[model samples]
Target chain A: MTAVAAPTRRRRQRRHISPVVWLFLLVPAAIEVGLVFWPALNSFYLSLTRWNGLGAPEQVGLDNFRELFSDGVFREALGNNVIWAVGFGGLSVAGGLALAVALNKPRRGVGVYRSAIYLPMVFSLAVTGLFWRVQYQPDGTVNTLLGAVGLESLERQWLADPKTALYAVLVAAVWRQVGYVMVLYLAGLKGTDPSLDDASAVDGASAWQRFWYVTWPQLRGVNTVVFAVTVIDSLRTFDIVWAMTQGGPYHSSELLSTYMFQQGFTFLNLGYASAVAVVIFALALLFIITYLVRTLKEEVS
Target chain B: MSAPAVTAPAPPAASPSTSHDRQRVRRRGWAFHAVMVPLTLLWVAPMAFVVLISIRGFDDIAARGTAALPDSFTFEGFRTAFGEGAMGEALWTSVQVTVPAVILSLLLASMAAFALSRYAIPGRRAILLVMLAGNLLPPQILLIPVSRITESLGIYDTLVGLVAIHVGFGLGFYTFVLHGFMRSIPSEVTEAARMDGAGAFAVYARIVMPLCRPSLAALGALATTWIFNDLIWAITVLRTQAKFPVTAALLNLQGGYVSNWNVVAAASIMAAIPTAIVFFAFQRHFVSGLLMGSAK
Candidate 1:
């Protein structure tokens, strides 16, 4: 019996310690390191130097960082990113939460409504940009509708104007994002125990009170996810802006992501671009670190 | 089984109260519909407009501005878009890149996810965090180095290069998602396979993989739409118009057809079709997958 049991235990140990696990991890790990991690690290090194695509990089030390603070466009880009983070993020989350609450009830045709709302999210930002670009034309659908409603004075060249360009893009972005946040919150609502809602109702809680005290707490997980996604998405907003206005009309809508792309690819200022990229990276990493800490703590607990 | 009983009206003595409650519920439901139906229509109106504009005659659009109702409908824009516009070629290029990228990323991600979640690997938490961070990092940060690397490796300006970059970048999110999914699977199933003398590969390929069909489908659909819709990587890596994916190609079409709303609208709608189809087809899995990643 001892011999049989010992052999069995040894076999189990061998199975658990199989080399295939290492093999499985090897290629993906290599790709991740080579493509993403290495490149990200290289950006830090590149930020300290001045290089065009064709020339050897010259080490400029802190000059790029110094210039970044003083550069007017960079300042504007940074400011726009902040506005984007706050405006787009706030609107999407709030709108999504509201929609989710309204749609959370078991009503007929709710699925159809949800799908229709989510349809825009299925299209690429490119499609969204073009669609809105068409709508925002001086005599386009938005203005036409406004005219029909006797609000012709309110209509303007939405994407062409500096003051409204970023907001215009933000509107299109919010259109797509609201659906994503709604779906997440909807999922969170589904997981919530209905008994708690019923219990609150029985205790004479009003609808708003029940939501504020009970449903809101239950949705905390989804709120964090929505907040993180919104922040990251706001930071990485490029495609729609690029497609719509190309950061044009004198760079009114320039975002950090778009600015970095222009610097690196268009102007070929690799080092300066790297500095911009590094700043963007730093901003994203801050939130990423916080999120990881929270998630990891949860995991360990 | 008891649903109908609870929903059914009460006895005659309580009929008046029950009827009043029924009326109020019905009114509330009607109000909900009143608000939701039009809001949903408004939400879908932009895409509906794209469809409406796609088939309109160019002459009609030019004669009367984009807001004008079409006097007649034709597939002239599609013909132009697919023919001289070369949208068909761009779409083909997109397919060439998206299909392999989705398949390869899913394959690699599932393998990594299986090991990280199933095995007692060292530094598992660190690995997970790194992948998640990589996914969250803006692609602009890696643009220069990755472009240079691709050029050095002789894959730059090639579809293969774009495919590699997409697979690499996509791996982070896919791995994160799959890791969540795989962890939720019962360990006993794989252990049972092990007891039957199945090797690690067999346990993964036969046992674990088969059980993960729902998640695989979900990720596949989501990734396909994402990679297909990708504009940045394609624009950065691919140079020639011949190699341009639909998204990048649409940009080119926009440049040429800036004045021609009909052709541009048609091309944009054409580019949107595949993703729209994929989203609707896998709607259930797609939503569940998103929730799985976030709600954990």
Candidate 2:
């Protein structure tokens, strides 16, 4: 019916938005545009000027970006962020997928198992960080377990040591994230057709082949959501790292977000922080834009 | 056989194959339990450790270290955290921020979603896509300017400012999800209402909203957890310790406690309880809402 009525409807409504539509859109658009989009756009302008919060911002053009490329700490921060993206994304996706697959089928205690798995996801990252800090202490469970297991050589100050701090923080973050990813994948799995699995099984396909061919194909939508979520998350990760290490032990775990916070709030280099923020914005946009474009194409058609 | 008029029972093929399938499933189930039991325990271990520490005395923890079995159990840590740590006030502050933010964001999002989905509205696609991308932008990107805006508005250090920011930041994702849901509602139903001379606002409030309850509930649960747990925005706009949300206050507690594991553990647990309750209460709706939104 829509296809049949398309032309007339399009011609009639193409440029004419009803007043009620405007009434509905006005407040949300105002809040979104005024608070979020406008400031975000202004951040770009701020990136080109130097300011210390007390004085008026002075125009410096691309100097901040130039300094960013050469600064050693910024380099370390950028590199750590890349590493974080890889480790956090890779582990959470893989682990979540595995758990989702395992728990997809309902059983006697599936709910209990799932709740336990997803329990960590509900904790605030600040809580997760502090909780993990206790676990990572020198005499904490981790080190104690290692000592009991005769792996004492492998135990050290997990958060205090620069070499292990980033990975230590990443582990805690992934612990919190994996369950969330699992829940998404589980929802996606619910939409898959069981008959397809049966058909593949009847054809004598292996479990791996059945999953790769039949099940995975049906999860395209969830994959899109998950990928966007993971990428954006890895880039913008702050609370856990901030709470756990503050990107500390010689800036070993410093992410772009934490570094930006440090630069803007701690040091008051508002311009350079905006520059870093712009970099984070650009990277996140580069990803989410691709997702938005795809979603838009689907919606339009 | 009672079915004498019926044909042969398909050579018993379905029966044998189904039983075979069941056997294989049973085996897989056993394997799953064997693996998942250990993994689940491992996942719960850190949480368990925190609870144990929270109940134990700080003197005991200091003397025996965090890994040792508890020698003393007391509610002193909880008392200290709630009173001296100021977590009790922060919890109330978090409630003030999260409840209003969640309600406002859901209201605005559903309204915008109803309009965008039901009407052509020029530039609708661009608006939706921009909001979608905006939701994904790192908060740090808007940190400096947003704080500046808050300061200039003289609402800095106010819960009202924090609530507004949450609603603003939350609008994009909430609208996107609600739009997906509202689009899935059959146009015929709304058209019938329109034929009855219901105005758009009437249709939205009476028709669209009631149908979007699952999605709204899901988003409400999610937005509550997110806004309650937000530390960055709280730290950014609000400076007074008295006004800090639970998460920000927990961070402060971590700082103040230093290596005092008992008090910190109690405070962390206090900070997490609200969201944990929300998560469990709405777990079903949350998953179903996400599934429905992505179903299209």
Could you say which candidate leads in TM-score? 1
DockQ, all candidates in order: 0.57, 0.46
Residues B1-296 of candidate 1: C-alpha lDDT, one tens digit per residue:
01222223455676687888777767877888899888888888777777777778878877777776777699988888888899999999999999999999999999999988888677887898788778778898899999999999999999999999999998978888888789889776887888899988998999888888999998898889899999999988887887899999998898998877878899999999999888878988888767766665
What clash pairs does model 1 have?
none
lDDT of 1 at A191: 84
TM-score list, all predictions? 0.95, 0.93
lDDT of 1 at B133: 79
What is the model-wide C-alpha lDDT for candidate 2? 0.87
Give candidate 2 regions above 4 Å deviation.
A6-18, B1-28, B289-296
Taking chain B only, the TM-score of every model is 0.93, 0.89
Write one digit per residue (lDDT tens) for candidate 2, span B1-296: 12232122244556877767666767876787799899999999999999999999989999999988889989999999999999999999999999999999999999899889888877887888778667777898888999999999998889999998999988988888888889899887887897898888888989989998877888787788888889999999998998999999998988898877899999999998998998889987755654544443
What lDDT is obtained when candidate 1 is compared to the true structure?
Answer: 0.86
For candidate 2, the per-residue lDDT at B134 reads 72
